[model samples]
Target: MLHLKDGLSFKPGLSDLGALASHYTVVFLLLTHTCGGQSDPQPMVAMAGDDVILPCHLETAADASDMTVAWTRPDLSPKFVHVRRDRMDFLINQNPLYQGRTSVFNSKLKRGDLSVKLYRVKLSDGGTYSCFIPDLDKESTVQLVVGQWILRSLDLFNAAF
Candidate 1:
């Protein structure tokens, strides 16, 4: 069983699968802070054929020019979407689908910008992404909402309100 900070617990294997399948998870944030990490809580919305920037930054605004920044989607195999190390892209392990479709603004790295731009968004791209700064021992997440799901989400939101 995995236990969360608020005392919520669940066994993560077989039994949990069906329960998860029956649920519609709206949004969730998990911040593993060893050194303060920050990310915009509002998801970045984009159409299926649009380019989008998933934003993340350090709460302390420390220089990240030479640090290792890893972007990954926990639910994907060979999860790496992008990885920057020593001020250059280290793409040897990037997922094939993301090849030639992601980039970081080198000019902004020095100011603690760890965001990545993803091009030609697809419906499969809708999910939570994890940003890890190994040097700072911090991690944060951002969500990408694609296409028609955005409209359905808004409808659900207004109904609840």
Candidate 2:
């Protein structure tokens, strides 16, 4: 004999299953009513010259060695400030203005790394730099900020006085 225990819920018998199924159907229908959809997350945010890392992910297993990866200051004429091609040490097409500076931290391409390092970052470098991964047809950008204040105070005055 099946006994109904106190505070314990039991599955309804086949005869009551129709009612149970209808109850579930009603709940599912209620939840399916949409309110709205979500927006895509912004790709990049700015940081001071403390070295900002632009995040990018690979979508393909194809060779990125011959892919044309470009990083540009988008505010201007889409100037090709930096172009990386092949796995042999990314070539800095060197904007006449960016001379004596700008190096890449790009490591092994097979492992899918495409990071660039800007050295002694200046105020003019405070803009968006986009890295285009053609193999995946994806672009990731990072904003750079330059600050005037030094993090540490000098001890020159104590030595002199």
Candidate 3:
């Protein structure tokens, strides 16, 4: 027996495979309908040395005051880019590489916004970042691409010459 926060309950009988399959299909359809619609992650491209916002928000506009939000990059050392709990930012385990370079929109948290601002984007910063809300069991990812401004400028200058 499995219970979900949305008041959905289902029990799988080991003796009936067909019944289990039907139950799974029903659950899938119910979940898709209840979730409204799927929104693709917004892609972001930024130049080196520039600041960028990585956006993440709940499907439903609900207060996130008590939610635990975590931003992480699996490929980076000291994985945690930022973490917030009980409406407070925690940095004890934050990656030193991102020290003084990351922040969340505190004012918008109550509206379910968990966007993060990353300063001075570096080449190494181009990667996938996960925004997770543990209590809600919801997560989303944002893709970041970092480009060199100097190279782009030089290319434009050479083309003009």
Per TM-score, the best of the predicted structures is: 3
Better of 1 and 2 by TM-score: 1
Error of 1 at 104 (Å): 0.5
Model 3 regions more than 4 Å off: 1-39, 151-161
Off by over 4 Å in 1: 1-40, 148-161
Model 3 over residues 1-161: C-alpha lDDT tens digits? 65444576656467544644433322110001111124633344457778888777888888887789999988988899999997789988898888889999887888888888989877777777888889988888776766663333333322332
Q: List ranges where model 2 is wrong by over 4 Å.
A: 1-55, 59-63, 88-93, 150-161
Cα TM-score of candidate 2: 0.51
My TM-score estimates for the predictions, one after another, are 0.66, 0.51, 0.68
Error of 2 at 108 (Å): 2.8
**TM-score, ranked from best to worst:** 3, 1, 2
Give the 10-residue window scoring lowest on summed lDDT in candidate 3.
27-36
Shift in Å, residue 129, candidate 3: 0.5
In terms of lDDT, the poorest run of 10 residues in model 1 is 26-35
Clashing pairs in 3: none
